[model samples]
Target: MINYDLYIDGKWMASTGSSRIEVEDPATRQVIGSVPRGTKEDVDKAVAAAKKAFPEWSRTSAKERGRILRKVGDLMEQRKTDFARVISLELGMPIRHVEKWHLKSSIREAVYFAHMAENFEYEYEAEGGWVRREPFGVIAGLTPWNYPMEQITMKLFPAIAAGNCVVLKPSQATPLCACMLANIFEDAGLPPGVFNIVTGAGGEVGNCLALHRDVDMLTFTGSTSAGKEVGALALSTVKKITLELGGKSPLIVLPDADFRAAAEEAVYSVFMNTGQTCCAYTRMLVPRKNKEEIESFLAEEAGRYKVGAPSDPDSDIGPLISKRAFERVKGYIEKGIEEGARMLVGEVPGEIKKGYYVKPVIFTDVTNDMTIAREEIFGPVLSVISYDTVEEAVEIANDTPYGLDSAVYGPAEEAYEVGCRIRAGGVHINGADAHITCPFGGYKESGLGREGGTFGFEEYLEVKSVFGK
Candidate 1:
């Protein structure tokens, strides 16, 4: 049993409040560990510590901060196996994917951020003036459970590199991984209070951190409703805010495309991480003439994904983060059925009964107004809608409330042309590849700011213009 505690001011401490959050392994529905259920008092202590440490940390050279970040990345690499196991146990990602992609990708994000920080321009001269980018003191980082380490790394690395201290509040669903991350920062010899972790419910510790006047900026990754609440709370003090919110992205397949290949890629896009990712391509648009053929292909591909224990190396899909998520996804699946969407593959209850698992569900004849097609169902549920022409396809793809990401599959030239017309932060053309360095975010309500690449670093920085001096 791994015993975990909150990290504050370079020391491990118990929660200031009288509550504890028990983390469970979704695969087995068993309690894996418990973390401090922090409160407003805990948030106060963390912000005070960060505020005190900011002066020294901000004074440190950029190269020195980059070196420390590199050390942290190295430590993360050394403990890849340990981190992978923890992610599998707590978040219920397949062990193989956790080791192969999740752990390594998170480490790479840190290392990449460090490399970017080394060459980032903190100050530049303009017409009769100089623009300076400085860190916002005491950032409050609130990350989600889906990609705990990746999201935290993306937020913390840049904030620290930009000379800011952080008070991170990772979701209670996967707080153990956050604790492990705190240990890595400690091992890397970061300055006292430069990085701290507070684990608890969003309404308690998370809200407190967002509302804390001492916190200069607030960065959050989660649902839009939650984002709105956090934004509202931060408005009290007018703190800087950056949000990476939800998505119901689309994957459009033209009649000229290879149906088989597109179907496989579409399934992979949404089903990866059990469809918990914010940028998952949940809605797929196909040519009306080839709708039946595309549906057959999608059903065949969906049946190939094996949903089971996260510990199973060969399992393609694992249980959700908790029973609550499982129930919520199930309810959405039921709503889709009641709304008259045709279920082509997988059932609501699915195969597994003991764990919080739902198999891949693909719904055909789904209209844009259907609940499954319109709402952000963060599960392995795919909705297929039909379009008559290229213009119609583009219209359908952009009809949703989200504009975070979209994919176009067809002839290279046609796909590229359609990709240009879509209003999204990022577009995948012909399943080319997902660029880590590209700016990732939405245009409207999907998110307020970008994450990944150079734009992400700018989120933690404040700009000041110095008059002719």
Candidate 2:
């Protein structure tokens, strides 16, 4: 029975628009809550408040800003249980994973950004005189439904640490967690209008935020097509834009790699977060000689993933964010079948009965040009393509417009070499896990700018070179 409202300026208020978005639990197909369908008017009010807060907020001492961030982190940690529950219920993530990874990981990211801000050199002597990193004034942070807290924290923490005010627009599908985040900032005593949350459709609130004249920067995380629109709109006013868009990344399995280990890691990499991750390794490139063996192993491993209720502790996969996403994933599965890709594992549209569930799907003998291999499905679907040599593997991996992330699986030395040759921003060797302290982003259409560690902090800042005295 939680009543969600837009957090504009320093107060929680109802949207001026007549429209409202109903939040639903994908697993049960039940309406959880309703969020206001914010309009351009709402975006204007938020940007205005942020602009007004910027003068004082940007001038605040870095130490004080860091202190505030640290306090926000502490508050979030205290409410970890509640946050995890909300995420699991809203996003249909397993409760155990929500606690182990989503909630805990997001808190760590905030803490990491706070620590980085404390020691960051805002002003430093360089070649001629001094260089300073200044805040970009008001920033609009548009986050996605998947990894709601993580995405929000990734953008908002760094923006605030760099002394900028933020107007965050979390996805209407999972706006509850963002509301809780706003509560954390309020309880942490963040200055009025320094942080705001507005929930609505991307067409309305997102577009308005990007086109708002007062907004100095627009940070977006979503699909490539949506990103194109946001980028174009932001460019109209020439606002600074940081886009972490879609990725159809590749995971290369060298001939000498352990077939069992590679297959297991590949399935986990692509299927985690229900394959909704922007950088999910959807395309797997294996040596032609070992294709049959790897394909068999992948089929076996895919079957092991238990897809069911999010509340079930043993459930390995959950429902898509909504009915639309469910249909989209189902449609892609069907497309793979029609396009001549062999369905090596799982069924199309998955088990029928309830919710927005889709079983893990694997396609073998897939070509790079196939729709399943080329497009970003954003589902628990994997396409296995065979490559004749390491050179061909690199070519296939680099063929995609995205360069967000890629993985090299083989003997330690050989994998390292291949990783060096890959064009992605982050390369995982031998299934090495994602590191929070490292910079994360794509090289090409994957994204603009990074979103982790000190590299991420730079996105919220503008460099100014001071002339010699």
- Clash total of candidate 1: 0
Measured against the true structure, the TM-scores of the candidates, in listed sequence, are: 0.97, 0.97
Taking the tens digit of each residue's C-alpha lDDT, what string does model 1 give over 195-254? 988889999888898878899999999999999899889878999998888888889998
| Model 2 ranges off by over 4 Å | 350-352
TM-score for candidate 2: 0.97
Report the lDDT of model 1 for residue 19.
80
Residue 127 lDDT in model 1? 92
Q: Write the per-residue lDDT of candidate 2 for residues 1-469, one digit (tens) a residue.
A: 4568899888999989878888888999888888899988888888888999999998888788888888898998899989988998899988877877577777787778878888888899988899998999999999999998988998999999889999999998899999999889998888999998888999888988888889999999998889889999999999999999999889999989988888998899778789998888899999898899998899888878888899998998888888888889999999999999998888888554678888888999899999999899999999999999999999999998889999988999989999889899989988898877898888888888888878889989999999896
lDDT of each: 0.88, 0.89
Off by over 4 Å in 1: 350-352
Error of 2 at 144 (Å): 0.4
In candidate 1, the residue pairs with backbone N, CA or C atoms under 3 Å apart (3 or more residues apart, or in different chains) clash, namely none
Q: What is the Cα-based lDDT of residue 430 in candidate 2?
A: 84
Candidate 1's C-alpha lDDT? Answer: 0.88
